[model samples]
Target: MPYSNIILDMKGICKTFPGVVALSNVDFQLKKGEIHTLMGENGAGKSTLIKVLTGVYQIDDGEIVLNGKEIRITSTGEAQKYGISTVYQEVNLCPNLTVAENIYIGREPMKNHSIDWETINKNAEKLLDLRLNLKIDVKKLLSSYSVAIQQLVAIARAVDISKGILILDEPTSSLDSNEVKELFKAMRKLKDEGMSIVFVTHFLDQVYEISDRITVLRNGKFIGTYEAKKLLRIDLISKMVGKEFNNIESIIKKSRDISFKASEVNFVKATKFGKRGTIEPFDIDIKQGEILGFAGLLGSGRTEVAKLIFGIDKADHGTIKIRSKEYSYIYPLKAIKEGFGFCPEDRKVQGIIGELSIRENIILALQSSMGIFKYLPMKKQEEISEKYVELLKIVTPSIEQRIDNLSGGNQQKVILARWLATNPQLLILDEPTRGIDVGAKSEVMKLVAKLASAGMTIIFISSELQEMVRCCDRIFVLRDRMIIRELIGDEIQEKNIMETIAQGGISYGKN
Candidate 1:
């Protein structure tokens, strides 16, 4: 490849924040008409590098060359002027605004020095048609559309700017398979027209599907860049994780085969668990010692299912029975009192207490369960913290260390410890291993198995099919807000789960 054809280049980029070197001597290049993917475990400096390139952060040491010209980009506007735009995972457009208004917010087409609504809508429609494969109504309010449509609208707006590079940061996180296919088509169209694209995502399959080349980052350093087609999935994973992927499958199978006699007691039983317009009613049973897995594609209601069980949202039509007593409309406090613990999906937003010390965070759920005024004695609190710190192997200098100061993996462990300390009979873990490293993920999975073995009922939710297959004795597959299938015994495998998700029907076990 000719280096002269590079449209964007960063050399020896170094960024630091307080105690962390976010990025160190990283070099990245993007060529015109190519989709260059940035891949790494979360907090591997992918976001930091993007921030540096997009003018969100000024690099301490490095040079950025756009179109062979070295220029200073002190703000987002300056970066946009050089033809760089970013669309984050969350759609940042104003939801209340019309699609047309969102598309042309700052640079509206004007008529007679006044806002030109008609021409703006017409122009917005035209611009969208050029980039998007779907027909969207420009006059519709953004909130009226689904997440996939809103995301496409965001991309359409970015395409209208006609600039140097476009960065798509986890654009398909909430999109379904069909929606992802549509977005990929739009990306290809833009690439054909000579747009340099920087794609950031955790989904490995997507990286291979859409990218021309891949750049791997690990722990704030650039590992390597290679042609997408030339790299194997296992090799890519190994690079991202900094080790040979462990034989998680064998371990899980062994754990599953170590069968326990079915207990007469049910820890959690829901007759038709669901909320109207959110999740479809489905029956679920968690025995005293079992790890039940929830598996599905994005927007498949797996997380919604967890929410209903945890009482994050009220179920419109369902009866939950814990220890043979039926309860009506369970709430968070009630769920906790009834021996339930939940570790929500988004760790930063829902799981961690960033401002609190690790010990305090670890004891949050237990404290809530034991009533706020009934604080644990200092000695007992220290003992609880010490036990879990060693149990989960959380990497903190001390239990008193602020949870925010820990790495992503350690922070996740702290959250897990919080729930574990509650001593709940049923633990609900939603995407427990998300954004963590391989070693940490393995550790967490092993812990789940151990907990189940120790008679703690568990419900594990993950977007990764292989993880679900390896971790649970039974798996529930959901699609479009409904439970499509359930897999148990020997049927729990990656291929079967993917097929069930694709077909939207139960093949392995009865509903």
Candidate 2:
């Protein structure tokens, strides 16, 4: 229970929107000097509970006790005054300013009615270098530092403002393996200093690495809390997703078993297609009605290649051939007109129109392809949205609901629907299942298999090795912004991919 030295206790927390009961009688407790992780699926009320605790959303019913005293935090300032602070996934500090200036931007030390620049720089340097064991020059612009260092600076500022409690929401989503290690070190140091941390993330491996206690929530209800060491990974997954681990695997296997046959014709033939400083020149041929995968580590040019192919960034070298027609260069509108659709990796920023409704979002690509003058009627839009909403099992009450109101899984479904509506010949999906739950991931994979079986050419890119192995007919192993090796059906195993990534590439002799 980790209750001997309780710092924050939330009981009977309930919150609801117009048609959604976001949180219902949820309970959470935090022990002093410990790292507690909040685990759940996209619609499982993890964010609602954090909002309730941080005063971003007023609870419908509940009580929050901090330091054995009941308190109400009406706003972000009030929460900070009560010794609670939060750092979100994106670094919120100004990159143009010096690291020290960002650390004490609004609240600066004053001497003789002037800002104490020297003292500020020294304290900032000491706090990061000594207190957190992070070595960085505080005088340098924050933009010069990596994302990991910027995140630590944001944490330093939060700790200085509110030292009692810290909430980190998806803090390591953008970080690589090494960067994650650095962040974990800082987290451990803070825990040793008697700070209570509420970590909200989807990366299970990271959760096990840094969490002292784990609290599971599902569908706006409190499941249970357990010591990290005592809770098995499978059990935690089951609790968070309400599915047996074996059953989840079966679902993926079922989709993987769907028979796929490669076509003889090359739907896309790229000859040394690349952009300098992005992805090195590479030649490849994508067959009709097959799923070709691109596997690599973070910053391995997976997204860069996709961007170059889709005309988001025009390639500086080589040529592209679609349906036996050669082209020297292409752009977005031209690609759309040529029956190409792309779903970006970062769905929130690059894919969905948050404020728009599901119907509007679904028709975006189709509308763009048809030209601005060829407006789709409201009735036709409704038909398209309703058809996909049912087909994808989107789980939304109505198509008029804002896309932002839907869960991550449903939002992803809508984005897929947007591409499907255009009936494109070739589709590119980048990390389609990221940041979603296990169930949603399985469903998305199944949908991909179904599409491929129906004679659609697709390019699938994912960081999860198992996913790439399951859905891709052939994979291109990339490293250092170059395609190093290609794995056919039998060779596309997770171990093989890992080995190739570790040892640069597999030896296939001279092709």
Candidate 3:
């Protein structure tokens, strides 16, 4: 409704890579003077579609129409020349440089045969003031500024290409409420000035607030586009996942079952586990061959519980028992010695050692458990890593290959292999399937099933209720740092989980 003119149009786009179909016959359109939102789940082909549009990738088929003319953007620079610019989720600006220097790094003003510092700072300040209503010391190092300010700086740089189409990808992921409001204000300003923008984000509230139109993608295919006001959030979610919300009954019945009786709790037991401000005192028990799930929204104390259980964070109260032996305070080393393995939520930051080889990372945690003196010989290390790589179906050229060079799913498998090498009695995986493709997710689920069937106790945590219902034998629903609801057998359904989350863990009756 903002404008009748179409600024950009991507039609019947088809893109593919080895072992993956990123985008297939997808169509996306953006109107002038409107903020269009691209919505999808992880591995929904949002990033691939964006890459194809921005010239980060060359399309295998279909055509792109920009301002009523067919255009093929082969590189980032060429995309910019065609009035298309992108500010990615991660700010790509140099942190050590000044705000002004970062904005105009490669394109600095030259005055009187010298670098024009005065002109650069002045121009940067002017741009920020006019576009984003931001007042900052442009001379200061960009690192000194907060992430919110840096996001604004990135936008200021992108919007400098006047009348251009700016693509903002998950810019609000790390921002607080006030910062997000300020960002929305800046976006509105850009919209008012007749600029077209493609906004990609996972936040539904933000999408409804800022987007004039919504486009949904699912499994490398375009679903449909609708005006923001007309499309309900529930419908959008169903479209993104290719299933209705009410049809989640299928998730409750899984293909795998616990090989050992799940009625007993012998593996790990938390008696009023509390970490003060971190997580409330709660009791949870798991059996040797049981898969327990923790489900909650962001900041709902899911990760906090995992940290407390894994000894990453010291418990302020309560006792943890492993195989009927109580430990009042279990430190990281002690947990490792006690046969506990933890795969952190953030794989890139906490799990993978980017510079190290797959073999090195796989054996690092196991080596720590054995102590420095119990060194694994190079040949033995290769065998251990090779065994897991093949067992886990990790696609790598060799065990010596750098873990960072592999895809996200492969890196996740490496993390799993690392934990598995220790032969831990209990494995705690927090959001293990995040940021991986659907194929990898399936593989990880299968692996979890296999492990549980092998009599290993596993704690699974995920934001996706469907996944929790599918894989977990029993689910503990947490809210505001407390165990509010526990679902078992017939109660363990996606609908039940959603009702608990929405209604403060009260039973909504059987579906």
lDDT for every model?
Answer: 0.82, 0.85, 0.85
Question: lDDT by residue for model 2 over 94-193, one digit each (tens)?
Answer: 9999999999999999999999999999999988986579888899999999888999999999888876799999888767678889899998888888
CA RMSD (A), model 2: 7.3
The residue pairs found clashing in candidate 1 are 83-163, 83-164
Model 1: how far is 416 from its true place, Å?
A: 6.0
Model 2 regions more than 4 Å off: 1-3, 245-287, 290-338, 343-422, 428-454, 458-511
Give one digit per residue, the lDDT tens place, for model 3 in 1-511: 5678997889999998997888999999888998999987666888999888888999999999989999998998888899888999899999999999999988899989999999999999999999889999999999999998999999999888645699999898667667889999999999998888899876556788899999988879999999999987656756765656656665555847634556475778888778755677888777777889998655567888889888899998888998768987688888888888999999999999999999999999999988999898998999999999999899988898999999999999999999999998789999999989899999999899888888788899986777888888889887546677888888887767655654565421112
Cα deviation of 265, candidate 2, in Å? 6.4
Off by over 4 Å in 3: 245-247, 250-290, 294-335, 343-363, 377-417, 430-455, 461-467, 476-489, 496-511
Superposed on all Cα atoms, the candidates' RMSDs to the truth, in angstroms, are 6.2, 7.3, 5.8
Better of 1 and 2 by lDDT: 2
